[model samples]
Target: MSETLLQLRNVGKRFGDHVVLKDINLDIAKGEVVCVIGPSGSGKSTLLRCINFIAPPEEGEVIFEGRTWKRFHSAFNFIANRKYEAKLPTLRAEIGMVFQHFNVFPHMTAIENVVLGLTKVRGNTRNVAREIAERSLRQVGLGDKLDQYPEKLSGGQKQRVAIARALALNPKVMLFDEVTSALDPELVTGILDEMRRLASDGMTMVVVTHEMNFAFQVATRIVFMDAGRIVTIGTPEEIRNTTEPRARAFLSSILG
Candidate 1:
């Protein structure tokens, strides 16, 4: 069996008085594609953000690559926890993320956008960055659109560029938060196809998506969340044949 690449131990999150994620625990093995499915405002995105420390959990340990990063008790302690903060750069570099919105820089060409991280974060030379960026873009089937700016590309193309940008970082795991949600219906399949290709290549991925068909085919495990907690987690076959009342009702509503 593959090793656990990432884990959330009793993770919790809140916004003022509103609780979002509650005591969420999950384990993502190497090369495992775990899809998180839930209705709107179920904290799927928040969970991913916590993994990347974009939204640090108020109470929990984010164990990635065997290192445990914990939340500080007080706001002042949060910043004072330099030991944990010091690891953020390396952790962020090792875990790539793609959001629902294609956040490519508008002025930069697709190639330029992909090269930014290699040059800026990893500090690779511009020439070396371009070489790696070219390969990454090609991997996403965007070699011909290398010079195209975001404004010139379709919604699907823009998302591909985002994926390629993340790929260039050579992350250990990839987190995708509803990456196809903003695309047109026809464009959704293209993005999902690219994702399937990534999974085929043994890329460990954690995706939060609503497309049940894509989830059924791509996910090694399906996690159903509701009211700030995981309701059920099972294999695609088990999920499809579940008898649990809450799981059945939720699946019926979404898949029907």
Candidate 2:
């Protein structure tokens, strides 16, 4: 088995008085693709954000590589009041995230967008970043559109560019939060196809999506979440065939 690349222990989060997550624990092995499926308000996106430190958990340990760090704590207790901090830049570099809305800079061309992070964060020279950006764009099947601006690209193309930007970081794991949810139905497949290609190439990924067919087809494990906790974790076959009440109800609702 591959080494565990990421671990979450006793993770919990709340916004004001609303609890969003509770004692969540999960381990993601290197090269494994785990898909998270749940209804809206189930904390799926919040969980992904916590992994990348976009939304720090109120209480938990987020372990990446060999180092572990607390992501958050109560502000009331002096000991726990200290803001959770770690090697954020390094950690963020190791885990690339693609948001639901393509956050690409509108002023930059596809290739330029991909090169921005490499140059700014990794401090690679412009020439080197451009070369790497081109290669990454090609990997996402966007070689011909490298010079296209965001306004000129389709939704799928823009998302692919975003993916290329993330890939340019050479991350070990990728977190995708409903990446296809905003695309038109006709454009969704192009982005998904790129994701399928990435998965086939052994890029560890954690995706939160509502597309059951895609989850069954691409993920090694499917995790179902509800009411701020994991309800089931299993292979696609187990998820489809299980008699668990939550699983059945969720499947019935989505598949209906």
Candidate 3:
């Protein structure tokens, strides 16, 4: 496998006339944990979406594990590009996403939720899926909650189940979009702790979060964004001690 797990060059996204991301460039290496931070509407989440092609970029290219996709001109000239359609599913399978809201099925047990993707998407047998689900749940500390439904699980536990669902696929990269934002303050650390464990186990992760503590502690690199562009990219210590005015102000506003 390539050491460079994912790369984006000059990626851009727009909604009608409004630009959500512009000239964004990023590289995520294997086993790296990168935390992205910025104020609302700063393109933090949009960058991750572009990485997974959930919302493909309008310009530039995305290269993942040696496969490449480029944006091109269309007859309508509307930022439309149609390339790599066949490989998209395979690309997406290697990159997993966990949303802020725990989007678990109301009727399914924790194990069942984790196994759905394995059986449905990956074509695994029920027995095989259950084994993977059980192991994944254990990884997230939800072993005891396997048979419990989402409604019976706490916010943190539900989020763990969601994480387990993603883990069952064994994605090469995990994208977490503010996974702790909707949880109760007390439950937030549980999810953060799970993330920390994953990082220690060498999972490559791109996390868009407001949890500065988690970012400071676990991130191999921190990316600061503003106005749809990355303003600063550094290690935790470099970011904390940055003298750049915009970076300083943003850090002070959040850290202090």
Write one digit per residue (lDDT tens) for candidate 1, span 87-185.
Answer: 678879988999899888999999999999999989999999999999999988899999999999999999999999999999999999999999999
Residue-wise lDDT of candidate 2 within 100-150, one digit each (tens)? Answer: 998989999999999889999899999999999999999888999999999
- Comparison by TM-score, 1 against 3, better one: 1
* TM, every model: 0.95, 0.93, 0.92
Rate residue 153 of model 2 by lDDT: 92
Q: How many residue pairs clash in each candidate?
A: 0, 0, 0
lDDT of 3 by residue, 1-256 (tens): 3389899999999999999999988898999999999888899988998888888889888998888876444676443333445557777888889988988888999999988999987989999999999999998888888999899988989899999999899899999999999999999988999899899999999999999999999999999999999999999999999887888998899888
Q: List per-prediction Cα lDDT, in the order shown.
A: 0.92, 0.90, 0.90
Task: Please state the error at residue 204 of candidate 1 in Å.
Answer: 0.4
- Which prediction has more favorable lDDT, 1 or 3? 1
TM-score pick, better of 2 and 3:
2
Best by TM-score: 1
